[model samples]
Target: MTPTQIAALIVAGAFVLLVVLLAIPLVKLGRTLDEATVAIRKAHENTDPIFTGANSTLTHVNTQLERVDGITANAKTVSGNVSALSSLFTATLGGPLVKTAAFSYGVSKALRARRKRKEEPWGKHSRRKGGRK
Candidate 1:
């Protein structure tokens, strides 16, 4: 054969050998991918019940929170009502009671002063003239 033809034949043989070497690892990768897919499917199947239970639990928790929110709203309303009642009582009762107490104290003081004046033994001018003339 000529040198150019021999070189071409060698190149083709090398290309075929490279293809054969690469195919072995490609087949192995495909098989590993298949196994991983099956394992993922099995895991999903096994955990379905757990996912269902979690969903049910989340629903229950949401319901309880809604109930708590309703209770809190009621408590807020009650607190507001109590505050209004306290304000009303202070307005209607507290003002008059304080005025009555002040009046009673003033009357008592006046009576005490009157009694002291009556027990004195001199008139106002005599006392002012230092008990002489």
Candidate 2:
């Protein structure tokens, strides 16, 4: 062969070697991508049941929350009723009750003072000698 022909053949052979080396990594990369796709499919299948269970759990939680809301409404109504009853009692009887208590305390004080004067019997003077008793 001519030198030019031999040089051309050498170049072609080197190009083929380079293509072969690149093809090996490309094939391995394709296999890795296929494995990743399979793993993703499996994860998707596994997550379906988990998502279903979570949905059911959320539904139940919402139901419980609704019940709690009803209870809170009832409690609020009862609280309002109690507050109104308290206001009514205060409006009706609170002043009179305070006046009665104060009157009773005054009566008690007056009675105690009368009893102490009766026990003393000399108007602030003791019966003992030199006022030491």
Candidate 3:
């Protein structure tokens, strides 16, 4: 063969070898990109339900909080009514109760004084069982 034709053949072979080497990496890169795209699609699909569930949970929590607010309001109203009822009871029965208590105390004091006078007369002293005068 002529030297020039041989050099051209060598250059063509080198180029073909280089193209084959580059194509191997390019094919692997294409496969990696396809896998990444599929993973992204799967992530998107999974996250949709998570977001939906979170939204529904928030809605339910808000509803429960509203019920709690209503319960608190009712409790306040009941407390006010109870306070009013207590005041009414006091207003209706307080004076009579005080008067009755005072009358019983006076009667008990008079009975205790009368018993003491009967036990100890003013002109006499009693002897004890174990004593000397």
lDDT of 3 by residue, 18-116 (tens): 999999999999999999999999999999899999999999999999999999999999999999998988899888888999999999999987787
**Number of colliding residue pairs in model 3:** 0
TM-score for each predicted model, relative to the true structure: 0.63, 0.88, 0.57
**TM-score (C-alpha) between model 3 and the true structure:** 0.57
Q: At residue 100, give the lDDT of candidate 1.
A: 95
lDDT of each: 0.90, 0.93, 0.90
For candidate 1, list the clashing residue pairs, or say none.
none
Give candidate 1 regions above 4 Å deviation: 1-9, 100-133
Ranking by TM-score: 2, 1, 3
Candidate 3 off by > 4 Å: 1-37, 122-133
Residues 35-126 of candidate 1 have per-residue lDDT tens digits of 99999999999898999999999999999999999999999999999999999998999899889999999999999777776776365623
Top TM-score: which candidate number?
Answer: 2
Model 3 is weakest, by summed lDDT over 10 consecutive residues, at: 123-132
